[model samples]
Target: MSIDTLARTSRAKRKISARRWLVPYVFLSPAGLLFVVFLAIPIIYAIYLSFRGMHVSGGGPFGVREETWVGFDNYIRTFTDAEFFAGFGRLAIYGVIAVPVTLGLALLFALLLDLPRVRAARFSRIAIFVPYAVPGVIASLLWGFLYLPSTSPLNWILNQLGFADLEVLTGGALFPAVANIAIWSGVGFNMIIIYTSLRGIPNELHEAARIDGASEWQIAWRIKIPLVAPALVLTGLFSLIGTLQLYGEPTTLRPMTNEISQTWVPLMKITRDAFARDDLSLAAASSVVLAIGTLVVSVVLLRMTQKKAFGDGS
Candidate 1:
């Protein structure tokens, strides 16, 4: 082609390439705007608030209160607060029970559903997942009724059977009671993830194992479990993060039982500080600490699992 013709063609190609690059950004603009407004701005504002404290400005101790920079004072208070550390201790206990049990049940259900001849698999899946569909507050209320001695049918049944009524919502039973709610709601979601991963595994692998005189259980133990390791890691990470941020269920159940204090968990404590106590600076500091702890835990967990799950040596 002549130089003039080639120059015209190059200009048209450049325009097409430019338009292609612009299209994705155009489509992404709404989400980008939302992230900045809802997440990024709020985070930046919280970090700023963390360093600010309210103090009396002028005349006396009861004088006008003003927001002032306090450096790491809020953080110091957060670290030193017994109640704050107590909340984490409670979380550790709760998580130890909830996380493993939830994931274990999920893995079990997923495996059962993945069997070659699972009867009513669709119905079973829905039955399991329906709890997760229920709102946390609503589910807490439903369980609260069952837990209350006055309203519990289990208590009525026990009375009929000459056994004492159980105190499900109090003392030692409280942790397991709270954990049951989490497990009931959480298992289905994690199950779905594992089931999806199981489905992605090639049928040829299972058939080949069977032909080699391997039992179904052996195939699952040796092949299926290894293949779905990534999904397990993902669900584990999500569960750990959720455990760290436990709030709604415990908060909702707090009114029903005195065992759950106002600052039952870390999130509840943060909420109380921010709203109930009118200590936004302390709340912000606590929130920043929790967020950082969550990030570090998540990164460490992912790093530890990646070599086994994703086969990433790096």
Candidate 2:
């Protein structure tokens, strides 16, 4: 080939390569920039704030809160606070009960709805999901009334049946009561996810199982469950994180009962520190710690489940 022709061909190839890479990047730049600005920047700022303290000198509305770096002072204070540790202990209990029960019920409902002969599937699905659509504050208020002795239908029913001293939001019962609310509000959404995953599964897999004389239970256990493992992981991860951040329902229900303290959950404690006490540094530290704990626990749970689901048993 002539030198001029070779040079022209190389330049054309380079131009095509540049455009090939450039188009996807051009398309991706908007989303990438949004994430960096909205998500990444805020997270970085929170971490920065966590390692610093604030000082305010001037009086009245003209006062200034000066942020001063203090290394791990805020984190040290957070770790030493008894109330802070107590929140985690409470959350651990809530998580243990809520995560399994919520996910199990979600899985069960999804399975039942997926069944061929289930009656009123549409109605049942909507009824279950309706609770999830209710605003969190409203759901808490409604459930709060039901938990109250004066307005409780269950209390009235139990009274008619000659029973007493059973309150849903008292002492040890409070944990489960809160868990029930969380479960009710979350189960429908999880069920929908699991159900969608179930529906996406090809029918051929089920037909092959039936030809091998597998019962519905066997098919669900051996085939459907493993195939939908990824969806389950995603649901479980969300549940785990949500359980850790248990705040809104408890906070809303707090006025209804004395059992729920202001710092009932980790998120609540952080909010209290940031707003109620005006300790933004401690709040930031608490937030960073909570973020770390959430990440570590979630990643660990997913890893263990993934290994069991797909790893070589040998």
Candidate 3:
């Protein structure tokens, strides 16, 4: 080719490449900038604050303000504090009860909705999902009232059945009560996600299985479940994270029940540190620890599930 023609072609190719790069950046800039500013910056700041502690002057009397950095002191305090550790233990228990029950119900509802003979699927889906539209605070409030002995429908039903002295929000019942709230608030959205994925499976696959003399149960167990593994993994991860950071339901229900404490969950403890006691450094440290814990748990669970779903050979 002629030099002039080659030069022109090279310049045109460069322009096209530039446009390709520019187009992606233009499309991505808003989300990228928001993530950096809001998510990345706060996470970095929290990590920085986690390693430091503050000081106060003038006997640290009311309204007196002073601050200094004490490296690793705040984290040490968090690790050594009995209340902090207890709160973490409580959250672990809450997660154990909440995550599996919620995800199991979600999966069941999703599968039921996918069934061909299921009636009122649209209404059932909307009814199931309507709870998700309610704010966590409001849902907790509603459930709190429902747990009250004086006004609760469950209490009324028990009374009608000639039973006395029922307390849903007390003792061992508190665990299931809290778990139920979490499940009620979470299941519908997860059900929708799973149902969407279930719907995506081509009907031809099911037909092929049937042609191979597979029963409906076999089709579901061997084909549908395997195909929908990704969606289940996603829902499970989200449920795990939510279980770890449980705050709103317990916090809202605290005023109504003596069973819940101010530091019932890790996030609640962090809030108490930051605002109630004005221990911002300790709060920041706790926040960082919780965030890191969440990341670690999520990574481990994802890896384990991925191996199970896809096989280690992959």
Candidate 4:
């Protein structure tokens, strides 16, 4: 071939190679733009707001309030606030009730469904998961009516049977009442994840266990559970995050009961600070703290479970 022709061919090949590289990025551009606009920008704005506060210049009611750089003042205020910490305490109580019960029920349901000769598995799965399909606010409302003494069928049944009324939405019962909303909505989703993981597990292991004189229960407890540890870890982490971010259910149910205070959970407190109290800086700081705390917790959990669940050596 002529030298000019060879050069033209080489340039053509280079252009095609560049086009191939650009194709993936072109496809990814819309998603990347969305992430930047919806997620990254909002996070950056919140962090910026965290470091700023409204300063009152000159004094008294006549003084002008202006946005000013406040350094760590917001964070300091967030840390020192009794209500903020109290919200965490409430979250701890809620988590203690919700997380274990949700995960346990999910795992139990997944296991039962995985068992041989379990009739109506599809219908059962749909029934369990339907609650999760209900929006959190709607679920809270549905449960709220059932909790109210006047409207509750359970209370009516007790009255009919000559039993005392149960105060579910008050005092100590309030915690479980709120937690139950979470448990009901969460279990089906977690169960689906666990069941999917269980299905992925090879049947040969179960066969091998059976051949070695192991019962179905032993095979599940030994081989299946261990193999699906990673799924459990994933579901547990999700539950932990959901527990920390508990807001919708409690907030929805709050109007129905006085037991849930305005600052019932950290997120609710943040919302109040931002919107109700108009303390944007304080709310931003609280949000940043929560986001950091959640990140740290997720990291710690994954690190601790990596070896056992994921079989990671590092």
Question: Which of the predicted structures, 2 or 3, would earn the higher TM-score when compared with the native?
Answer: 3
Name the lDDT of candidate 1: 0.95
Model 4 misplaced regions, further than 4 Å? none
Cα lDDT of model 4 by residue, 61-117, tens digit: 899999999999999999999999899999899999999999899989999999989
lDDT of 1 at 275: 97
Q: Please list all clashing residue pairs in model 4, or write none if there are none.
A: none
By TM-score, highest first, what's the ranking?
1, 4, 3, 2
Sort the candidates on lDDT, descending order.
1, 4, 2, 3
lDDT of 3 at 228: 89
- TM-score, candidate 3, is 0.91
Cα lDDT of model 1 by residue, 182-227, tens digit: 9999999999999999999999999999999999899889999999
RMSD of each: 1.3, 3.6, 2.5, 1.3
For each candidate, the alpha-carbon lDDT, in order, equals 0.95, 0.89, 0.88, 0.94
TM-score of each prediction: 0.97, 0.86, 0.91, 0.97
**Where does model 1 exceed 4 Å of error?**
1-6
lDDT of 2 by residue, 120-145 (tens): 99998998888899988888999999
Least accurate stretch of 10 residues (summed lDDT) in model 3?
Answer: 55-64
On the 0 to 100 scale, the lDDT of residue 146 in model 3 is: 93
The superposed Cα distance between candidate 3 and the true structure at residue 197, in angstroms, equals 1.9
